[model samples]
Target chain A: MTNETGAPLLDVSGVTLRYKTPGALITATERVSFAVNRSDRFVLLGPSGCGKSTLLKAVGGYLKPSEGSITILGRKVMEPGPDRMMVFQEFDQLLPWKTVLENVMFPLLDARNLSRKEAEEKARHYIDKVSLTRALHSYPHTLSGGMKQRVAIARGMAMEPDILLMDEPFAALDALTRRTCQDELLQLWEETRFTVMFVTHSINEAIKIGNRILLLSPHPGRVKAEVVDVDTASPTDGSAGQLEKEIHDMLFSQEEAH
Target chain B: MSSKARIVMRPLEDAGSGEVERELSFLEKAWDNSGVRKVAIILALALIWELYGRWTDNALLFPPLSDTFAALIDNIRSGVLPARAWTSLKILLMGYAAGIVMAGILTIAAINTRLGSDFLETMTAMLSPLPAIALLPLALLWFGLGNGSLVFILIHSVLWPVALNTHSGFRAVSTTLRMVGRNYGLKGFAFIRKILIPAAFPSILAGLKIGWAFAWRTLVAAELVFGVSSGQGGLGWFIFENRNLLEIPSVFAGLLTVILIGLIVENLIFRTIERRTVLRWGLQS
Candidate 1:
């Protein structure tokens, strides 16, 4: 699970994302570098608009870095591919027209060289795994908020991507629902051992779900700190709340320093 | 207290609570029954209209609801209204279908290329403000007093709104949805079919509503001026001929039929479809 073999499951090096403005360029993230091993739950922790999601987008191939490069499974990613699936923040990520099962089967239709029967089988498998077997025929609109995210998660997992990138996927749900989904996600990860790069603002969520957390500074986001805690499985019941608060204070100390 | 007294008091209290709960449940059920409520309202309005129309003395001003219904029945039995209605429906469907198809192609093209979008915007801006009825004289000259002329006018009525709404709908689709589409590696028609079309459906339905109204009005006006097409007269022709003969009640009959059809189409067909699709999906309230 190291890059010593000259290959990593996910790799990002010297990545900078900038927006070109009329008078000057606005940088969102600068000099970001990390490599994720196989089955690693890597979390990018930052406040809103800190370019954490932007970095996820960069890895997902939705956006290209202004500088540096990204590679997955030793292949340089210049464009979005089915091999790197993204679970978006919005629940509408699952197409409303599709039933839950169909939504999960969508990528297989486009990405894989599988038959319809094969795709359906695989989709049902993932749907069942997400505890959505009863909702297989239900449309996204009929599902509750937590249910919608479960469908999206099932859709991404069914794609069997080398790396799954989530852009604050549970942020919009209610607190209780978010916690439930967080635990479900952790359980799913334990079962599948899928490589995941999750972006979140909540330090509590980051510590609970991530094996390693990368702290990003606000406004022209940059790497502030990186902590690898291999101690706990996901969905920590506030046991690590003190450690998370410490990280939160350190990251937000800009206001205090000023 | 005596055991007999306690038994009577407890039973009486339970009965009272049960009755109140039952009434509350009924009210709750009624609150949830929106579809039933809507139907009831429509029926009540129709009844009121019928009663009012019958009470009116002037046949020229307000033909009794019975008279309108009887006239509609007579025309249908005589094969007059059906033939004419069929003709109108044919032209309407043809021109409407063609307009929608062309608009869809144009919107897709517009989304893909900057030049196409620019051209579409300019063309829609130029045409949308100009009434479709205004194009009749030119259409008559070009297509020469037939179904072709009516179709040309119909196209003028239907095209711009569909194209404009579709283009905007495509533009309005959230980037997140688009990214999800791309993540699946869908390109070209596949992407549009799976993502753009469904995401843009609400706006497209609105465009369809506008297009239908525009086409309906334009068809009637065109037929009034042009008379008939391919020797087959439609509802518009029936109205025009009745007016020329100064048959006021018959003209009222034709007008009433038109209004009825419009209402039926709007409330029953289009709205039903909208409810089952966008509204049911919770994409639209």
Candidate 2:
């Protein structure tokens, strides 16, 4: 995929991920190719164990693919760096000891050439962006699941990474909270225009948040389908119900077939 | 309206105000009070002990709380207690500080190297069960009748618990947290500081508490066993001396001081720390 405005933010080509456990070498994903444009909300949707999260991890540079390569803004990802930050499913992703503000400020402290004051300012900006200004001094234990994820998101965004990787970050949240967070994420993206690669099993979430959704098959996940959201300019409106239902049906039938 | 219907209606009309009044009365009566029960239990235990002490009439074997407190007051007034306490505390601090520093370095080294970690695990496995008091005689032989001997035993008592706790805490930090730290480009000491240390804090705090208790107990016992007084002996030495002289109440006094100190350190210092850090954070079970 070629973009006219700017070069693609993330280009993942023929990526294959594998894991070796006690007995056998398990193939997680195969021949996966995708390009996320600058500020594109790219979503990977699949069944459990279909390597959606693995793909996200690979992009975040936590997992080196068994084969092929991933590049962010023409720079190849070799190892985990400050270029890409990830929001994880587990609320415990935030360091329990650090307050909400501290957790947000964490990435900036390690990033190059930022003083404590500067980091604090940057962290505060992102924390406010995530609407967690009220909970700044409160520890992770005091925050609810949604609040914790917001802190994680704030922390990830504070780094100003080239791409934000989310591995089912809202999967643990309740329905009402999940929708609210999804809306907030879209708002943040609209404002900041940071690239995102999101993984989720929920079709509704994929359709609602993703600019482009890529579906993967189970058992060594291969790209089954890609749906472009040209018709819906805005992701979250009451009218997207039809689109959500259609995608839901597609995923359900796909699962039934397998 | 029928008579029976009128009776039912009248009762229902009264029920609302009566229910509220009953609820208020129940609240006033303290329907679910545990404070009284707790006080009662403590008083009952004290009464039993007093009765038992009266029956035995043995001042040496089982001194009453009153007798112990009186002796404690006398010793404190005479100034033998304060001077000896200071000496013991100094030794305790020195040994405890040394042990903590050593354990921290070892843990850092261990975390970085597989071989170091394996070695630590093996050594801890071998040495954890060997009592600190049991090392007193050996410590005496090595350091020869001074604070050095007491220091050695205190170090032995402190090292294992602290090392074990720290190492395990470092190990138990979530992999996701580590990955997140690395994702932000933190490595080596930065990673351990920002990610591992905080994540493992509850465990580390537990270790510190245990190590402190061990060190405190070991220091006194070591002193008692090897009391070579250059005009100063710790609480344990004081007790031993008092016992030898057949000053039974003073012996009881020394023992009481030890208990008091332990209670103060544990409840007043360490308990507050646990409450503020681990319990407040909801990290500890």
Candidate 3:
């Protein structure tokens, strides 16, 4: 699949993101470059301060890179658009006032220009995909944390964007629920083969979810290495453990050196 | 898996294992009901007021609860108190509606632009602390002693709290929610209507409640002065007139009517809105 790629679906090149704090100009990521092909389950794996989430935000067009460019399907992303839908880590990402169905349907009606009936039909399809059909009328607050995340996923998938951007999507869930959610996400990907740029600090999650994983270094995040053929590293097997240990050593060895 | 010693276990009791449904005692049931508790409190307060009035035995200063009730019933029958209350309510509604509309515009402005936000902050800081009643003399001079003057002061009282609360509410909206709204390409008024308004509704409802209380009291106070000059006013005028005539029971009745109106608005109007929107949406308790 890597050799078969043609001009990669989304190209992010040498992007640097910085923001001004009270007293200092903090760099979130510096000169990070990567390409996500069509239907690629691309994962950004790093420590908490590595700014993988910031890169995802830049890709989502919520933040502009201080240098370099991010282009989706040959167009530079200048601002947030419906082409890239994001499933946020925070449970409050789903509109509290909207029921599960409405939350999913909102972007469709708002940006996709679909008729109300069409939006509802499309929304219900995605909602059912997430196995939240029974909770179609329930508000976000009424749902459990895992259920809320599912609803958020449903809302994002309903948009059917060029690429889905996820920022530590299941990071807030309980351990058991998190595993189930990760499995569900993989199952959904298997069915649809939708391109996703998933950001996570968990090694297991990165290996399990991404076919290609980009390892990043801590603070002022820079691309450390890129690991390919991750889809072959099954989590239950010895190779997955070996891969996990390799990624961990690469991430923490710099800290020891410093 | 067989052990050396055999253990005997009792079968689980199905009846006791499930949830138990037991009827509450009559007094316990009554106390548990909110409406019943509220009514009980009101009755207890009425009893205390009656006892105190009787103990004092000064009808001119403090009419007994029973005498006040009689006067209230008499005025209702005569259509005097009803007319006065209706007049006050009409002016109050006008002012409240105008104030809310203006506050909405100001809040939208504050959310959209830096200058508008600064303007709102400055205006609220400068004007919110100034009592609406204090503006009555200027209002009287500008709008004359009528409904116009009364509404002017009412707007003054209602506008600031509503604007300030709404602005704060908008500012407090979660970053994630804002990003979601922007991700959908929602801009300006549509953004406010869809994301900001519902997200900020609980605080906005609080603002509405504060604004209502301020507007109600300001109207009454403004009417007191307005009645003296205009020769026609609302509930405040009714109370002042009765006081002049030395009809202490009627004066107490007028004051009771003011409290009744306040209770009706707070419980009926605002509570219904809160229940339908904020509470139902789980934005507030």
Candidate 4:
């Protein structure tokens, strides 16, 4: 069964992702490598043209790697499964027809084989964790962008997946709301300690959210370096600002070299 | 103008608690009612019809509104109109249901495969614009002189619009939503039923409406033609008979019946569905 107790929860080794355009085939990621241990807050930090999101999608099993492999719990990723739940950046990720409660319960019922009552109870718990119990019945369209993201988070988290893939989830929010969401996410992480692979371009966000960060260079993304122990950075200690500056320089120097 | 201007700062005046609500005037209230407005418009049209018919003074050509109403009541009393209406409705439903099922199958196939999509697109382009009645002669020759012929034409009328709208609706579903569905391990028919159907419902409903309208008109026209060679038929046949017997008011009554049925289906059935699904879902205002 190749069951290794010490195997990383997610092991993405030299993975390459190629996608088709109208007239061309483009490599989105080239030999990008990273490993996420159990309960690791892994962040993929890069510029807009970088394939961080694409890499995350590959790990989510939405996109198959053209080269190398992504193994989760010693099993190769073949396709999207409940084990790797993804929360997309777009607010439209939440089903417009389903209320917040139903959105959270959908996967619980579909993949987890939960009864309706069980699903509802689990959904409510997650909704409460996201502080959205009052908005349980609200449709996605009626909610603010921040609220929609929370519902999406609740939906993803409720699945109790092995890993959660977040593709710049709070990127579209206003700065203030983005900060609040980031804080809420960290608080939620503190409670559940679930592993998450967050992809974002914001250096500050990467520093704030990631305990382990993998920096990728843009235009067919390639891994530049890995920053470990980001959790040591705190606002009071000024390490957060130092780490933010370090990330900025890393990206800037890589861009200059390119 | 001076480079530096003097600035004045003052405390803001206290605005009254707030203007929370206002009572609408009678005219505004009445005008705000969609049903009232539609009824008024219908009454106005009836008034115009009566005035025009009376001025023409040619009952054989154009019956007045009151005479048409009387004919409608008389036909109902005799049970002929209801019987004819039922016959037409029953046939229409049979064709409509068949068309919906076919459209659903085709659209689902199209979503699942590239070749199926091309097939749907090509078939819709070729057949959708070709008037369904234009195929009635061919339908008649193939199916013989009966409900079969009418049903074939009705199917042709209903199938294309439903397929086109539903296919396009399925296509228009957002990539993010599709990913979310798949992220939950939803695939095949489960993916379609859970994600695609609801996401594309507004477009699907629109297609249904267009198909119904086309089917209804085609049914009436096909019936009128059928009366030329066949025995008994629906409202169209009633109108044809009334015209042959020089009962002009009864013809008007038959025409009125068709319009009323269309209105009822559109307003009651479709509107109710729209309110319950898409409107409540905030897909449409």
Cα displacement (angstroms), candidate 3, residue B181, comes to 0.8
The true-versus-predicted C-alpha distance at residue A129 of model 3, in Å, is 1.1
Q: Which digits, one per residue and each the tens of the lDDT, describe model 3 over residues B152-233? A: 8899899999999999999999999999999898888888999999999999999999999999888888777658444546
Candidate 4 stretches with Cα past 4 Å from truth are A1-5, B1-20, B228-231
Cα lDDT of model 4 by residue, A173-223, tens digit: 999999999999999999999999999999999989999999998778899
lDDT of 4: 0.92
* TM-score per model (chain B): 0.83, 0.84, 0.90, 0.93
**How well is each residue in B70-159 modelled by candidate 4, as lDDT tens digits?**
999999999999989988898999999999999999999899999999999999999999999999889888989888988888889899
Winner by TM-score between candidate 4 and candidate 2:
4
Candidates, DockQ:
0.64, 0.63, 0.73, 0.88
TM-score (C-alpha, index-matched) for candidate 1: 0.87
**Model 2 residue B151 CA deviation in Å:** 2.0
- Report candidate 2's interface RMSD in Å: 1.4
Write the number of the candidate with greater lDDT, choosing between 2 and 3: 3
lDDT per residue, candidate 1, B103-160, as tens digits? 9988988999999999899999999999998988888789898888888878878999
The alpha-carbon deviation from the true structure for residue B31 of candidate 3, after best TM-score superposition, in angstroms, is 0.7
Task: For model 4 chain A, give the 10-residue run with minimal summed lDDT.
Answer: A1-10
Per-candidate TM-scores read: 0.87, 0.86, 0.94, 0.95
Poorest stretch of ten by lDDT in candidate 2 chain B? B2-11
Which candidate's DockQ is highest?
4
Order candidates by TM-score, high to low. Answer: 4, 3, 1, 2
